[model samples]
Target chain A: MRGPYTLVHAEDNWQTDMGAWFSGERVVFRGKDLFTELNDFSWFKLLMFGITGKEFDDNQIKLFEAIWVLSTSYPEPRIWNNRVASLTGTARSTCVLATSAATAISEANIYGSQAELDAMYFLIQAKQAIDEGIELKSFVINHLKTFRRIGGFGRPIINHDERIAPLLNKAEELGLANGQYLKLALDVEKILLKERFRQILNVAGLAAALMADQKITLNEYHHYSVLAFSIGNISCYIDSSAQKEGRFFPLGCERLDYIGQEKRDW
Target chain B: MTKEKECITTNIWHEEAEADNPFAAKAAYCSGYDVYGELLGKVSWAEYIYLLFKLEKPQPWQSSLLESVAVAIANPGPRDLSVRAAMNGGVGGSTAASCLMAALAPGAGKNGGAREVYQVMRLWQQCGFELSQWQQHLANYQDEQAVEVWPASEHPPGFDPYGASCTTPVLQTLDHLTSLCPEEGALAYLSEHRQQLEKAADCPLAMTGVIAAAFTDLQMTEDQAEILFLLLRLPGAAAHALEQKKLGWRNYPFFGDGLTLTNDPGPAPKEDNLQGAL
Candidate 1:
């Protein structure tokens, strides 16, 4: 509803494609009963339905959930995002804030949602280019030259991504491994392996290809994946909250490599 | 074990370890300036914030300019989506971090939030004071689609496409910020040629535009502007959230009849057939 605006677009009522609460009567979710009809649907399934306005099979839902359950739940507070959660907990801060800060940090460029989204877009575009008869090798090189970094590649600190094999095994187990995007991804890996040994298919690359194969639009993927790191992050928050204050890997002051202006008189 | 962690870090923060406890900070410094010993109580928040980003103390005018922009962004009120999100967290008995995260989630949007300011700051980097370049850039904005990660701005980054007019606050901010800058500064250019910029973009000037120009005048990196925009505006969200926490959700401006929910499981708003519903 329009709160304070004189613009023409300001309307009296806002429309939602999703279902609504009938006060004390019942709840609706995408034309289905939140209680009666879809009560048995898993949370991930419900979340996906709400995000994309479409129902997914249990197998698909399981695969999606497994991606988070297996891979994202690092539980290590040293990860930048999780570190915030740990700090919040150690500070005796609330879980909500810890999760919030952690999630916010998860929006980091290199290893977060933006990277995944960028990689997904690049994969989509790269696929189209492949279809258009652009040589995959040249397209890959040109993309590297233009973007400075390829979206789906680059797993820092480690030469290989440990997550890819498990993800592939899981996908194969679910019979969802046969995707063209995944194929394209492996083909790109072929080039990277030959040319740049260190650059390998990261989880972002694999996940992007899999989601692309699932035909999950960028917007849909974004909404569904916002809570991607919540499990591990929230765990750190709660666990550290129970520990001695500020004791989650407490750091000595000597660790800071301050490279700013030297201390001076005011 | 559910999960497990570690770390020490920062360029902007340093601590001299007490002789007894190395883990405990005996003295804190922000950008090599002593925090408690020197800068605190002496330096205004605007000056300190400026120092934090620019890594140097700002001149009086620069500090004043920064303060003016910070004041403008400090409280966007409840109607602003970010503040509303914060209020929701406050009223709902949510954690302060959650509340701030809620605010930041929307505040990071490309529409009228920090991201908008960031893009405009970048536009400033690209166009500077050349109205012709701005006009040309807005006209040929599609060129940004090439290597840029964020969505290529379809409209000019700073101006609000939905705003009907250049609002009073935006105009006032432009006026005030212009007063703080040199005659040849970015704010000065914006103040002088806002109409031309507006006509080129076909939208009214917004606070974001003013902040972008002022940030440009302050010589802040676009990345810094983006984060600072979110941070400076948090005071309002946080204050409102605290206020709303006291007032409770009942008084927290619910849009009754404003939300028309579709696909009701029980029945439509007009109909009342309830067979399989809970």
Candidate 2:
């Protein structure tokens, strides 16, 4: 798909990483089904794309379902045991933040926030408008004008993002979404713009909105959102770990002071 | 492939002074003769195939062929469509297995499953904790301290179906891999967001964060981690079973008293062997 050079690479990177993971012995267990693994990997692959600022695809949603089934294979004892351990670190903390963001934003979408829960309302409205095959651009423009009087890819981080449009494009072709869906997302973006922090219509919100617009069902959206966010978090964690290591030496501290004794004469 | 040939004089190679384990048996066969001295070498996959069918050491290629078929036989049933497609499409069994293991989360959120260890590790890393810190934190919550025990209780608030406790041998290997990861940008990203990560708690994002941390700690190239997770758990388990003689190859049943049980299943795929698989 065309639009945004970054999304293409993000998608490719995700697929390549996922393919490599899929081909490795690490993911495979002897007494299990192969498809479940592929499906799980695909879901995480899309999630990684979202992390890198790409859009979600419906095929990714199917993969999410497949992941759920595979995930269910473990016994309760094992699940709880593993999860408790997983929940203890900085990783768990970040997951909390990401989920909290999602929960808060979704709540704002459903309920009006002082700044702009209206954009979420608009998203639902836009979904209805698009369902009737209305001109999405007009509806979005009206909302954008009313929300913040901004338009197009010149506004904020959303516009600056390297991967947005292509994700929307792929979503459109998968029969899972359309351009108008993004317009509604733009509406949300405009609302986020009104916030103190220049919030962008993140991949999560847009994905949730798109899935919602396609009438994918709330439960499904919840499921996909959790899985996608979790998968995205995997990439985020990797990024974070790298960051942690790098911080051991600040920019100016590249070389240590030669304070210790000089070498003795040979 | 099923029936066993009764008797044959084949040269056996014994690398070990004594056959104590599966690897020792394999070494013995590879070394060219047993203590009693018998010819054990075969030249081709076909010849080795005949030998294995006759309960002898098949040549390496023949072993590979048999392993491939055995892998095929071990794949999930056709009812699991995605797995069938993956296997048919030529994805290796070990890789597929790890992904499946990670993906094996329950919908109801009420039972135990593969705890997303890689994901958990990833999150821990993201949040600014060292692997040791994360492992310590996880250990505090676990009921058991065994090397391979499950890390938490069942029905964790947000569970990863692919996790075991932090004590897995793979964790050590992951440390090795982490030291080798090439990308520096990802590291910068983590540092930039460490505070934000550290502040999160008990949410879905946190769960993802933890899983991601594990992945990062493992220095898992996504595919490599996926494959390793899959094969590591089950293969290790299988190897243990074989060593315990809970399962046996050929007519030497686990419960049988008179069987020779001389056949070796070879080395279980350890981290190095798994890396080779990659």
Candidate 3:
């Protein structure tokens, strides 16, 4: 029963730039001492730190805080991922389970991490193309030819995205609205608007452009955005739990369009 | 702007509203079976899940096969990459859902992950028991960059890349599942041709091969096999995560020497400037 463990047998010499603990002494976070060296950092600052292993100034942190507060902290229960949290709350589930499930639901095809990542990659690559002397209009049309769907440019339900204006306002207030990637995004929006593509810059596109301006890698953006809508999710959860059992969004059989087989006696 | 869709539509599920309230469901029907009235006590959880996913009741052997594979791979231990990811969440005081998310992210990988099971399931459909087909298929695999929404194979699908030999648990699982499989069916074909299959893959058969073979015996499609593989393996991940959560990070194995900050911390950021600005 005591043969050498096959799973981690050869991982004996592993090293990480990510920090480790010192038991009761202190915790090291991204090479900074949690209590001493990084004692002044806010939770938002620490969140960015955890993602990039770098620190941010107070103003920049305030800008990120504005993004965090205004961008996707949606408290709406009807939102797909938030509904999962609401359902979990209605069922009297644990916080971790509820948030995790909701976060998992956030990986939907059109929305969530996958779409966000796609948008960021597209923005980064498009900027590279623009830098390489490709005209914006020509590049936009050519990029459209490669795939039927391009993320970060459109809202699924409404042609106009309501979040874009608020985010832009915040970015303007923070004095970061005119960054190169943000300008590119707005320029692309103009092209699409003039050409009648029926899609506008959604929150993801704006956020992606802002992130790209900061040169955040796709992986870092993904990890950083994991909890994008947690505020809304937890709010939905709280509201649902405070109400009644199994009562988030109940639907009648008559409401359902069951277009399949009929009942049969087995 | 007008909303795109109308009311929700479904082929697999319908719930009858109570006589008094349209919002309250009195009974549920799954694929036209009275789930609460007719099927709840009559069928096993395994059969119930099969009916829910496949939209039909399973034969006894099919349900049994599904249950066996599900139980076998239920938890691959905290040492498994997926399970460890979950444990990482649990030990760090992350939410339970986050632990499962941790499980799914790495668990969905092609390296001994559910995606590998999906890839292997597709290969079973393409190759069956034919070793020559497997050899050709594995040899000629290419990346077309098709851009799937969910994960596909990241590498060759069937075998373990890191192992020195076929692990004992994998062989044992294959044996147990082989007993449940039809004598001449998918599991049998796999069990008989495992050596040749290993040779073709150029690595020992991992548990994903066995699980995928068992799913093949149940006639699960590649996509179904992929998702079910994710669902079935969550139990172990959740259990380990919760256990580690209670054990605290100190009790958790942070590695033998533990993680060290090998790189020196860079200069601290200035007061009015972001550190990562280009």
Candidate 4:
């Protein structure tokens, strides 16, 4: 019998050392035994290892894991992803479907984790400009003029993100704070605040700064940030599953406003 | 001997920069037509959009359908995910673009926006524009217990979730708009099998379905149809974001205190052994 038909050129095969199942035997993950060595590591450590291909010390793990723990598990189900999960739960959908659907929705450009990646990219550029002796205020002003919005700065609902101080404090406690990216993030915030922009470094901004400090590549930065938020999507599904059927904001016929042409014969 | 690798090529751009200046003075062509001389003020925005996508100008009916769809699905208020996200972004003091981006994110889902419509169009096309064939296919899937193929419980993409009795304004508008078009086979077929389709899916046809059928009738590809839907929804998203900004920042509490509950009760207070000793 012939092997599976090949579509791509053999030389162009993508390579990976991530992980692979071995039928009934043990699994290999990042050159370690999945059931023994890798299983002993914290999920955050494992995630970081997967993305950066490097191991971290205890303090680094603590700080990184704290950021994920703090950001995960949003209480509000009204958010797009959460709402989808809730709806799925109300309809008694499977956990896999619920989480998959919700996570996909969470990828929306506006408030999704991708925004964090964009904000981080902006910060990287802004920091480079600053390193070139461009005034922070001038740099910000120019950015605002060009893009009309600076990522990782202003949020939508609150004047300040309550998550910033605590994350910063955690970073400080771990003695991992005061890196170049963190300082730059603070400087940007100060300039924006001085300009009465009312923008503060949100959790996304801080996460970007920390990830940058680790010298994570652009691709890893995006992947890690998304992985950090997966918990929230899962929690949404779990929470929604506990709810009664047809109870997730069940909209009646009256709720639908009809302003189109009145009844007409086909 | 191994063959040499084939290099990907493109006609989209030329090496000589001087040969191609899209925005150059008095020398601009959109889809190979004189934009300044022939298209300006002569073609409506809808017709221009059609020209850009199809590389040809649309018929009166096509342009009319495009314009109608664009106008109809523009805004369904702040209740929509994208609009709500935009509003939330506004309240958080996010820039207009960031808010708009949030609105666009959830639109990629099967539940809402153009993607869902595209899925419906694909299914409809697979059925060869025949209602009976589609029904039979759905029934066969049902017989095999393939709930994933067409889950009747949830709003089957392109159908309103809030029961089949209620009619969406956009769907109604689509009905009138598509009726005017010369190529009304898709719309007519949908109308003929409305009851059967609704019964099979357990929901009424939505604006997404109507738009999908209309696009099919216009002989648009799935991608083109989806893009048209996105274009139609963009203005509505912008409006919602603007309105939220105007309304000022408002707190979006996930749920009231009354609805809050603990998932675990701490192992039933350690089995009351310490309490009994106390």
- The candidate that wins on TM-score is 1
Please tell me which predicted candidate would have the highest lDDT against the true structure. 1
Worst 10 residues of 1 chain B by lDDT: B142-151
Off by over 4 Å in 1: A1-9, B1-11, B139-154, B265-278
- Pairs of residues at least 3 apart in sequence or in different chains that clash in candidate 1: A75-B4, A97-B97, A97-B98
Selected candidate, larger lDDT, 1 vs 4: 1
**Candidate 2: which docking quality band?**
incorrect
Encode model 1's per-residue lDDT on A1-266: one tens digit a residue. 21236453446577775777778877888887776778888889888988888888877887888778766778988899999999999998788778877886786678888888877888888888989999998998888887678887887677777888898899889988899999999888889778764568888888888888888988787666689999999999988999889788776888787776788766
Which one wins by DockQ: 3 or 4? 3
Write the residue-wise lDDT of candidate 3 on A1-266 in tens digits. 11235446545565766776666667777677777798988898899999988787776677766666787798889889988889889998876677878887787778888888888877877888988999999888777777865679887777877777887887788777778989988888888889888668888888888877776777778888888788888898999999988877765557788876697543
Best by DockQ: 1
Candidate 4 displacement at residue B12 in angstroms: 37
Q: Sort by lDDT, best first.
A: 1, 3, 4, 2
Model 3's CAPRI class is: acceptable
| TM-score of every candidate | 0.90, 0.24, 0.81, 0.50
Query: In candidate 2, which residue ranges exceed 4 Å CA deviation?
Result: A1-120, A127-158, A178-209, A218-223, A239-266, B1-278
What is candidate 4's lDDT per residue for B1-278, written digit by digit as tens?
Answer: 99753332321111211244422343335545566666787889888877767766688888887787777778857778767877777767666656666776666456667777777778777887667777765444222221122222234666665543637575577568768676547777777677797666665667777888888877789988887777667677787777666677654533222221122121112347887798
Model 3 ranges with Cα > 4 A deviation: A1-14, B1-8, B15-28, B36-44, B59-61, B75-109, B122-155, B175-201, B234-278
Of all native A–B interface contacts, model 1 reproduces a fraction of 0.62
The true-versus-predicted C-alpha distance at residue B39 of model 2, in Å, is: 86
Residue-by-residue lDDT tens digits, candidate 2, B194-225:
33433232211222232233344334443433
